[model samples]
Target: MILNSSLLVSIEKHFCGNELLNGEMYMEGIKHYLIDMDGVILQGTKLIPGAAEFIQRLRTKGASFLILTNNSRYILRDLQVRLHDLGLEVPQEAIFTSALATAQFLHTQRPGGKAYVLGEAGLTTALHDIGYILTDQKPEYVVLGETTTYSFERITRAIRFVMAGARFITTNPDVTGPGEGGIVPATGAVAALISAATGAKPYFIGKPNPLMMRTALRTLDAHSEDSVIIGDRMDTDIVSGIESGLQTILVLTGVTTREQVERFPYRPTWIHKSVADIEVEG
Candidate 1:
């Protein structure tokens, strides 16, 4: 949604408890919110407490927000369907995935470039949407993204491709992720294997690399100073938000615990038990 001055003022009055009536004063109350999906909104297939209501509140208040995720297994439509099943009605346009970010990064770095992609529908679909040709025939890049099953042949091919002078790229640096059975190796783990074999480090295009955050902000037409990022992980979401110059809120309903937060060298702008405890109205 397009945020105008009047809308900003109204939101400020509702949340900030200030009726300064000036656009500048209202703008200080957060024009956009970048929210993480996995930990902060859902744990595995279940929705976190107050996640649906919090999203609804944002929609009802006409606040601009994006559900950002690093998992590149499912496309936007698939993710929307999953959220819908959990009773969370999020618009497809408001969802941003690391695969999409990687695709955007590639498009800017080398428009219409070809790559040997080792990923699922999310990554392949994003690359296809951006007109990136996926092939193993002397590709410019060997792009790696998350998948439930990492095939030995695919990893071998990716290693060979990288050794053949193809630059390596990955969606995110998450070494492990939650699975129905338990924790499973993710993109970062596979990337490490390829790196070990090929001695080529993959450029991570997802969280902790401010590029993804900046891209999401650009998509929402948001200013970093007037935006807030809500996430559960300090390593990925929080650090990315901070590096992107956005205010960060760390929620403890996911991988990060209250005790673990103290171990980080940097701190978020705000801390909460979960999305349930966050107050839009100050």
Candidate 2:
């Protein structure tokens, strides 16, 4: 009703709920959702008890969601195959990874810089798609992600380049990521080892940095208040969601245990055992 500053202050003393200080109103609604892949959706080789059914219900309700993961070992297609095999419907476009986020950051930071990659085809493909010139010969940057083919030689080369003043960047800072067998060293651990040797810390561009979350949000075109992020890791997923101004829901079906949540610095808005326990009120 076009209330002025003075009137707004006056109304605030008595206004609440559906009415704001200026007679404006706001209500939280769920429009888009971002979910963590490994723990929240599926754990190891099995889908979480109710994750698939929950997603189906969300789809039927016309809510859009993207499966966001900090695991950069697999590309979008790889993840899609895994999800499909689990009987969950997930499109490649609905998958976002730290590899993609790192590539995007590099594209903006140094468009044509030559990068030395220390990861699998996922990170390489992501960099190539973003128009970066990847090379091992006198690279201008050392891009690190999770790699199963890690070796002392690759580490030595990356350190050499970084020591020679090449920019260093990592997809995420997760020391160990959840795997089919158990926790395994992620890109963060590898990045740290390199940084320790070269004394050059890599800029992290994945979860908890807000870059990946923002990119996912842009892809969905979802308003901050109208969205929620569900994940298992408090350090990456939950923290990133909170930082990006989205409601955070921590599911106990993944890495972070129930007791761990209380000790976490950033507390989620809600906690559940799995998607099965959640009721999408929006």
- Most TM-score-accurate candidate: 1
Q: For residues 33-57, could you state the per-residue lDDT of candidate 1 as single tens digits? A: 8999988999888999899888877
TM-score of each: 0.89, 0.86
Q: Note the clash tally of each candidate.
A: 0, 0
Q: Candidate 2 — worst ten consecutive residues by lDDT sum?
A: 18-27
TM-score, candidate 2, is 0.86
CA lDDT of every candidate = 0.86, 0.80
Cα shift from native, residue 87, model 2 (Å): 0.8
- Which residue pairs clash within candidate 1? none
Tell me the spans in candidate 2 whose CA falls farther than 4 Å from its real position: 1-28, 178-182
